[model samples]
Target: MMASIQKRPNGSWRARYRDDEGKEHARHFDRKIDGQRWLDGVTAGMVTGTYVSPAAGKVTLTAFYLIWAERQVWETGTRRAMDLSVRSCSFEGVELRALKRSHVESWIKAMSAAGLAPLTIHGRVRNVRSVLRAAVRDRALSVDPSEGVSLPRKRRADMAMDIPTPEDVRRLYDGAEDWFRPVVALAAFAGLRLGEVNGLQLADINFLPRTISVLRQVQRTPGMAIEIRSPKYGSERVIPVADSLLLILSAHVENVGVYGDDNWILPGRDGGPIWPRTIAYHWDRLTARLDLNGVRLHDLRHFYASGLIASGCDVVTVQRALGHRSASVTLNTYSHLWPNADDRTRSASQSLMDGALAIPADSLRTAGA
Candidate 1:
């Protein structure tokens, strides 16, 4: 093992070293102490024969990224997105170790200027940062320049466009396909998530008790593959169904061909488990047919919450029905659904003034006049 210090023309200090394979590595530092600290760490690694120089500075950024991608086992849709991002930018012949903070900042700016959504930009930047973090852990560089970089803040769109009112849900259900109408009803009335709805089995429903047991969820992968997973956060819950919904569910089970004890309640036409996307597709068709504007399938759950709040259900109760991790989330998201107290306050104030002014005239005359 060999170590040396050199001063660059740019006035930065560089610590150079050679490993057992005679491969040379260099890391630049802004201060002499920093350079010496890096050299000490290298010396210790050399002594233990555990030194593996990332040698990223010697390879082009494009080549390094290809190696990184080989180690990533991204799901189908995520792989496509990663590929698009990698291909969209040109990092050819750029040394990985020499990557500066400005390079990353400029790339982010360019992505934003390209009219990409803030969320999309945030995801891409996060992916890039993950790769860089691995490189740092591998001792590819002295420091990670991408660290502490901030991406554009994401702006949440108005919830009104996404959440549907009870009337809108009723209209959607009226136009939905026979097999899907009850699904919408369950979502709006019972607050079951799409996955929970898809994962339901005939055995999990109790028509007499008017309650449904949520045990698992069916989700679709990026390539449209379907699988059943546990509910979000893996918490099993039971929610009570209204009398009307219980009756509808009972009829739906008989009409749709009752399933075996192990079969799902809402299976695809092939008799396999239903995918969430299939539900979304059916929802789109139903909304279009009914001319219901600005409503998504997930909005049905919002309708459920709004209905409960409008019916005088407390926040904690709504949170339980929606399977929200916390009551605060339910309150923050649907607080506007509850009536404003301003009107009540104004009316109380007016009543107080009237009562004060109309204090019986005979009593006032006896006391003062």
Candidate 2:
């Protein structure tokens, strides 16, 4: 039942509301009209399904967000990114119900002003919105303040992967230890992601067919367990190995003895697959040592794409080689990297004119005459 108001013997109004458990709350008001207004608001809140114990607003956004985050199953890298975004959030301490669109807007402005990239800011805003949306769903909040807040438009920098030059890749490849050389070469040449690279075994490579089959990927769960999962976007594909890369892989295979068909190519000390962060940790140190700034291990795949574009591979070829779900994904990432595209267009146009019909011959003969 909704709340009711009654006039006490002292001519004051006593407004009482019952909780779900039959507990009652009373407020003494100076005027009956004020009591009626309060009761009407309670009824309206009930109608809108926004009625909650008044104490619900006392839960802070940060406290509740932690609860929400804990229950989500996220990739380790994504979890780290979300953790960083939430740690830097300035508005997490606000009461869940008291958060306003204005507060969210101001936070966005502050974050943008702090010089974070649009993509990074977008991720941060998304994290906050995810929690606020959950709060609204669970009835701790009446509405999500993040609604109607503007987010950054994704640009090439946000959507496209950055590529490193062949020289930069060669430098890292040459500088890496022998144990890591095959890992670096395959990632740079075959366009395999770190997870896919880590999940490889001796049986996945084919010498006569000159192809390497990508079937599985390794990932670390939120609980720190090393698990084998399908490749990102489930991109199961066979990638042909360049002869040079095949030689490097052969050498790597020969050197790392004690291999079975199912054994990991790059196994951890525990004789299982290594975490992707382990690769990142070594890559971070190697890049620093080689003075290759802003280059990541993932950019090796971009380097591979760059090579394909330079070799005059079409969009569809690169898409399939990269195991992308669609050709547009390949174009979106490396459209700018296609070598001599403008020159080829100009050359093709000139060639078309050169092979055109000889309509001007009669006019030229008349001019000579």
Best by lDDT: 2
lDDT of 1 at 288: 76
Computed on alpha carbons, the lDDT of every model, listed in order, comes to 0.75, 0.81
The TM-scores, one per candidate, come to 0.65, 0.69
Highest TM-score: which candidate? 2
Tens digit of per-residue lDDT, candidate 1, span 27-58? 89989889999989878765664344765456
1-369 per-residue lDDT for model 2 (tens digits): 647888999999999898666767778999998988887877777788876556777788888877888898875666777777767878778887678889888988898898888888888989778878888777788888888889766686435567788788889989998878877888899999988988888788888899999998987767767778777767899998888887888888788643334677785646777678888888888899999868988888888888888888899999988999899888778777765668889867766765895345467579967
Per-candidate clashes, comma-separated: 0, 0
Which residue pairs of candidate 1 clash? Answer: none
